[model samples]
Target: MRFSLIMVAGIALAACSPPVPDSGQGVGFGNYEEYQKQQRARDAQLAGSALPPATAVSQETLAADGTVVASNDGSDLAAETQAALGQGQSGSGAATAAGGTGPQPEAVYSSGISQENNFDAVGAQRSIESDAAKIAQNRAQYKVIEAEALPARPGGDGPNIVDYALATTHPMGTQVYRRIGVNLDGKAARNCAKYASPDQAQSAFLSKGGPQRDRMGLDPDGDGYACGWDPGPFRKAVGG
Candidate 1:
């Protein structure tokens, strides 16, 4: 009976305790030094098995004379290019005979100006005597236009504002004429709105008893000008 009770107590204690985890089966809690040694061995093996060195490539280029040459030297390439240009310029006739239809050297470098119409070319071709003759011919064709008085303002009853502007020497806001009425400025503002521009307002004012009289009230300040119109520009035009 005592032996059986001891055996039963040992079995119960084993069952109550957690089971021990296998290091190889789950997350390894094994030798870190061993793992490092394995890694170092793998790196060394990879280093020893590196790929072979690449072979040097020899590049060949075609020369201008239709021959394949090794382009190892830069000087050789530049010499070949210069030789090609010289051959093209010197042997253009030979190339044309061999079925080449490219533009001639002259056409390629031409300034696009025809020799006949170019001023420098024409000047080179002309003699001093010829130039003097041409100048005389041109002068003979030219005519001197006599300055005539601008034909008296084509007879119109309505006063020409151009004439009025030229006639008036007074500067703006000089009050050349007399103005008397209630709210003359307000009347002018309202009346000026009816015209498109100050010039139009002045023209209309002149036609309907303006300058001397303020029938339309466009010239509120009695300056002979209407709707803030200035005669200075017109006066200046004639050098008045």
Candidate 2:
């Protein structure tokens, strides 16, 4: 009876106790160890595929005297650039030699006139003395032309009208000669129409009994003019 009671108490105590938790089935951070293992694998893969480190550029340094210390790596590049420049210059020279010649200098011309703004320079070239000398030279070349006598009239029995015009001093319309006829104005108009000009009429009138005698009745009022012939212009020309 005592042994059976002890066995029953042990079974009851076991049934009432809380269950033991599974290592893989906890509420928080139960798979933290597995996560750590996965993280380590990814890190290993990225490390294996990483790029190589970049090369460092060579830098120039300044000396204590403030002079630049150029890098040795740049010396070869500078030498190659200078060699290319020298080749280009030589090629240009060869092309110029193949052509006939290079550009020529511009031609300059000299002028008699001065280009300076100095008034004294211009005054020295042209003065009152120079102008007087030029005037004297022109005067020495000048010649006075004496008035020549008029040519004699052609041989004709008729009186010269020019002489009559120069001789007359009285104004026109002053009765100079006696006129007696019927319709003398009408006769004069008809006779004057026979001549081409007043001068020609006067010449014909004087040729045939004009001023003193009315043969053709050309001088109607007998002012010694025929067909309104004017002597004023002829007198003015000679200052009579």
Candidate 3:
């Protein structure tokens, strides 16, 4: 019984020893040390195999209300920025908002100018031209001084048909003679009833008006003639 017990103990001890190597055709697998080396290689392969969680860096951004936030990655970045900043423009039109269009305000204009120039519209050249044209046109029309001739009235001692008192003695028998620039002639003078030499008549009329036959004894050298009338004053001066 003691020898049988010794053999069983020896068998149990061999069974408890480290596992043996595996030998296939020519290769051999060793014990725990080889297993440890294989474990280390497997750890390295796992480290290389698992892709490192994709590394990324994020930039910080500011919000409209001054708070910090992540930046947006969308395509409409500029539009978003404008909206957040409240910087968009509004008006009747784009041109009007930019101050580029529309009717201009009125400006004050004046007529008088100080400088001298040939083309000045408000100057003397225009006035002279207008006057010259008016005068030229007037000369072209038939404007005359004496329009027509008048006949002399017969005067004589034959019944003295023309009354000295009743007849109005205005020259040419018309008050139109008072107006200036008229062409007076001898025919107009013969219409007067009483005969006074032209000078005496004119002088007497200028002094007091009408016949002054009695006053100056104007009929001095007259043979029933008046106003120094052998030769009248004007004719005597001219020796006519």
Candidate 4:
């Protein structure tokens, strides 16, 4: 009975011994696999939540020789874009054609001047004719008034004194003379008119009295006056 108890105790101790190293390695591998699976799931979730990748071309991309390549479905998108672009270009072209293209040069035009001159020769001629007419009229009027003459006076040249006296005294008239009939030793004194009327001559002679009687040697013919004026020639010429 003691021996049987010892064997049972040995068997129990053997069963309680630590596992092998390979067995521990197997357990670690299982834990590592489980951790990798969890990491994969987390990665997938993050990827889904993040923003999408960039598609446009930037300057950096161009420098790197990375051109933008449209997707296979981008052909249809390109066609639509091309149609819109064509429409815009057509509209712009129409507006430009109507508005005229490029900077318009400044407008230039030729300038010309015209001159005209006119003179009224007829008016000048009329003025000259009027002046001639006035001059002729004035000459005619003066000739009519200056036609008469006068008797000569003493102590000056012939007729000139008479003309001057006529022009100054009577202007336009006749002359006559009368004798005083005064007696002298050798000659007789005669009285004559210096004016137009015979009565005027007689009055002048008598008013001064007899010529030699009043003042001797004053009258050459012993007349009352030194000079005698006669109007016979003037009257005969004028026929009045």
Candidate 5:
């Protein structure tokens, strides 16, 4: 009974002593909260040191053969799809008629790019077809409604298709022969419509063709006026 009492008293004394620190910081284990904190820190450090296997962003992105598909951003989707299809054919024991080990690659098709950049947006195809179908009908109606009424037909197959080279009149109702490109390097080399007197211009115009002559591009607006030169004096003298 005395030995049992001594053993109990020794156990109590041991329990009362301060706990030793693991890191040898000379700091004894304090309260339960401090002990818990130290244990958590040690556990976290161990967890951080022993590295874990890297996990992929998505396992579905990998092909069945363990080759990583370069289709994370769908950049290689078409190629990957073609490869998968070929693999599928080979795996199915599909052989060529010549008894080849695997099926030969004939043509790999991808519906993704079948549009070929000519994608038909919603209603676009229907609109185009409708326009095409009604084009001839619309043209016929237009021709019937706007038929030209002429007193005499010109020397041509049709008025709409005039042979300008053979015809004399211009589209502007002026005589075609009057249209001439002039290169004036002398006599009136002025930049604009500068004239000493309108009489001189008027005389030159009448003799050669007044409105028909624009030697220096002076008549830019084609109002028979050149380089800011007024035709008032010329018009007045000629009663034009």
Candidate 6:
């Protein structure tokens, strides 16, 4: 009976006193390091890779029909001029030889530029070629009077000098030379109304202009020229 009473007392003591557990709960992962390398392998791979290739650009050109065209080859002014003049060569379909029954070409007016004309452009170039002294001389005289002034010879007793323009193809490379000269009249027949000759006064009035004539008062409306003189050259040398 005593044993049974003791067992019941122990059971009531155990039920009243609950046991303590471990009491630790999982709060997930702890805080990691503040900074960590993530893409090192990817960065190294990209750094080792080669770069992309460069692109090549081309030049621009034109067609005969006035169209803007682009090309990768070459372009020049001669081609453009030919395109402008509509003188481009025949395409693969057409025959290009003379008398080949192609469309009749238009009559092109070509002038015969004489050897003198050619020499005019070419000679000016050749004359300045090798001699540095000649170049310096030309530089010194460049628009200055290359020759001395000429006047009415010994007694000044002659008709007024006139401009004698000459055209020659028959002379054929004679190297003709010309220059402007004066016709000073030492003997004055009158006061202010003096001239080398009547012809000089007329040509001066016509070419040197009316204002210039007015300055000299040579042509007085049909009154008469050779009435006055400036005692100077008929024309002023420009930039000299």
Leading candidate by TM-score: 2
Better of 1 and 3 by lDDT: 1
Model 6, span 1-240: residue lDDT tens = 999999999999999997864334223323222112335666777889966556644466556798878765665655666775664453522544544775668999978796667967777766645577777878987676577676646864433422211111222223233212232222223322455665566545545443223334443432223334232233322211
User: Across residues 56-89, which tens digit of lDDT does each residue of candidate 3 receive?
Assistant: 5445566769987766554355667776556434
lDDT of 4 by residue, 1-240 (tens): 999999999999999997656653346576666778888999999989996569843322121366654444545555767997999887886777888884468999855432222135455446777989999999888844565555545763322322323333222222222334445322313322235654344334444553224332223343233344343455455454
When summed lDDT is taken over every stretch of 10 residues in candidate 1, the lowest stretch is: 22-31
Model 6: lDDT equals 0.47
Which residue pairs overlap in candidate 1's backbone?
A: none
Candidate 3, residue 90: Cα displacement in angstroms equals 35
Q: Rate the local accuracy (lDDT) of all candidates.
A: 0.83, 0.83, 0.47, 0.50, 0.52, 0.47
RMSD of every prediction = 13.5, 30.3, 44.7, 44.3, 27.1, 33.4
Task: Give each model a TM-score.
Answer: 0.49, 0.51, 0.19, 0.16, 0.16, 0.14
Q: Lowest summed-lDDT stretch of 10 residues in model 4?
A: 168-177
CA displacement after TM-score superposition, residue 159 of candidate 1 (Å): 1.3
Error of 2 at 136 (Å): 0.8
Over 1-240, each residue of candidate 5 has an lDDT whose tens digit, in order, gives 999999999999999999876664335654667788899999999988986568734423666688765545654666778988989777675445456656567997666544435557435555777878799788777744565555665663332211212222222222322433455323244643465654444334434444566554434344443333343443344344
> After superposition, which runs of candidate 4 have C-alpha atoms over 4 Å from their true positions?
1-50, 55-72, 97-240
* Local accuracy of candidate 1 as per-residue lDDT tens digits, 1-240: 999999999999999999897665435737766788898999999999996568754456776698988876567767877988999899987777788686656645666789988889888989789989999999999999997777765666666778888876778888878888999989889999998898888888888888799899998888788999877888887778
Q: Rate residue 60 of model 5 by lDDT.
A: 38
Residue-level lDDT for 64 in candidate 6: 75
